[model samples]
Target: MTASKDGSSRNTLQSELAPRDMTVTEEDVEPELSEFTTPVSPLPATERQESICAWIWDGCSMLEQQLKKKAIKTRFAEVLESEDAVLAAVTLPKFKLRWLRTQDRKDKAKASLLAECRKLVLDQDQQAGTSTSTPTCHQSRDSAIEDEFFSFEDEDDTSSTAESEVTDYFKSGAQEIDSLNGFALIKKISLRYNAATPSSAPVERLFSLGKLVITPKRNRLSDQKFEKLLVLRYNHWFNS
Candidate 1:
């Protein structure tokens, strides 16, 4: 009994007298993540939203084509299946029209030509406005009269080109919003993840760093400790 007691005391003494550990740095002991963030933009809310919508258009177009290595096409409305996408697609075109009117063209002959075209359009619009006095019920009939008047005016000017372009654009836009006759099936085809700025690149990079940092030499870490370190590193990124 005394021998067992002495052996237990010696073991306790040896454990207590073991070499003291060197100080560990928070950085050396725990994983660290670099700072990354979204920058603040100075644009107005409407302008910002318009910019975002345009980017979405560019993204969706590329997603269906460049990323897939196929000749796929998709309408803005059907691609996202979200209310915001629909609103952005519709409102963005209207905003573009208003925004275009504010451009400052600085060519003499071109400016004069544009001025003449604008006058013709205004005059055509005025004639339609005056003819609307025929009758409220005959408004439908008056539209045919106005169309003829506008057609006559078109032959005398290059406004025909502008007007045709506008009509064609509107027609195409109408078709885009048509699912049955216009936009067809939008497949969620696989994108080239390795070839583009995927949404998960940032997360994947951090995970790769995690793999590198959690080495065999540091494999003694408990799961709870490792998780705490990850959370700390994540928070540290934003905090710093």
Candidate 2:
């Protein structure tokens, strides 16, 4: 009877230590792990929209800063403010018509444009040793007035022309400006200021072409030959 009791006790102990028929699913484990895991609450809709807008504004501001630096380096502001540039714009038929229509004081507008042109021509002549000195602004203004008097006389003779004919004359005048012989000094100054590129993209492209041509294998290429190769490669599309 004592031996039977010992076996029964062993069986009871084994039953207590045995693994149960149990399974742990993800759903069952998630709740327990969730207590230690911090919940990531999404931002409110309004806050998310504001954040997106701020990010966009920052990007735009960065671009604007970059463009401003480029403009300063290229003297874009100076060119825009230049009196010679104003004359150049006025010489163009489109801008000339716009100025005529916009300015209430027609004589003043014409005199100002003419004065700028006269000054530019005098400056150029002085640089070329053809003139002893540049005229003062007052002198330029006086000369412009005299020229405008003669120009007005000529205009008065053609005042009887139809409005359509006047428009046609202005349109045809564009060709004269394009020829660059009508206002050579003014055109030269205009071209000088306007020729500056806002970006160095073309120069960068040339450098990239040089890199492709002057590889490790062709490192011993002569400078002139490398330059020629770069040019030819860059202008290859022109041939097509």
Candidate 3:
């Protein structure tokens, strides 16, 4: 009977200790710990969308300021009619998926672009001490004055034809747009936005060059020498 009691006591201790050991082993497992681990994604969906939209708006404003064209305020509205058009033109599958996922807010993005362009124009006008009034807004008043001076009833028809030409230009396909040469302002805007570098490759290359130049052996090289070396290294064709 005492032996039976001893066996019962030992069995209970083993049962309790077995669970504690199993729990410890599970805690050590990396995959099991993943349940408690934080996510690896850089940003949540909503925050990521806002970040990308902000970047697009900032790029639009910067490009507009750089172009310094009078008609740039309406250029985005003319070309980027909606998100669908831009997405259709995209060739890469990855980019298309990304655009559909994050930049699906067509109306909001378009409005943001237009607002940024307008702000850019207003800033430029203020800087130049020119009137902040938009020229397109005063079109009717200007036309009334022009009609009195020129006194031509067919002027409206001519204006309509010119507007059609502009519309046709925007509706042009990628190949047609590439072939265009005379539309400098349109091409400038397209080139600025479309021809953007996808990566910081050139900048990264410069950093790599700096690392090579500033090694222990040449640690004392002056900034001027470093600059010269960088130019010569990048433009090695000139040396030959």
Write down the TM-score of every candidate: 0.19, 0.28, 0.22
lDDT of 2 by residue, 1-240 (tens): 999999999999999999997888999999999889986666787799999999999999999999998879587767655665655665554565455443554444455544544555445544775456566666777786887677754444333232333334334546444744544544554566456658988888887777778888997888899888888988983466
Give all candidate RMSDs, comma-separated.
Answer: 31.2, 15.9, 21.3
After TM-score superposition, the amount by which residue 43's alpha carbon in candidate 2 deviates from its true location, in angstroms, is 5.4
- Compared with the true structure, the alpha-carbon lDDT of candidate 2 equals 0.64
For model 3 the local lDDT of residue 151 reads 50
Full-model lDDT for every candidate: 0.51, 0.64, 0.56
Model 2 misplaced regions, further than 4 Å: 1-74, 94-109, 114-225, 228-240
Per-residue lDDT tens digits for candidate 1, residues 85-130, read 3323322223312322233421322333334335556576679878
TM-score of 2: 0.28
Worst 10 residues of 2 by lDDT: 157-166
Worst 10 residues of 3 by lDDT: 89-98
Compared with the true structure, what per-residue lDDT tens digits does model 3 show for residues 57-132?
A: 9999998887775456367665555543553333222232234334555445434333333444445445664555
The top-ranked prediction according to TM-score is 2
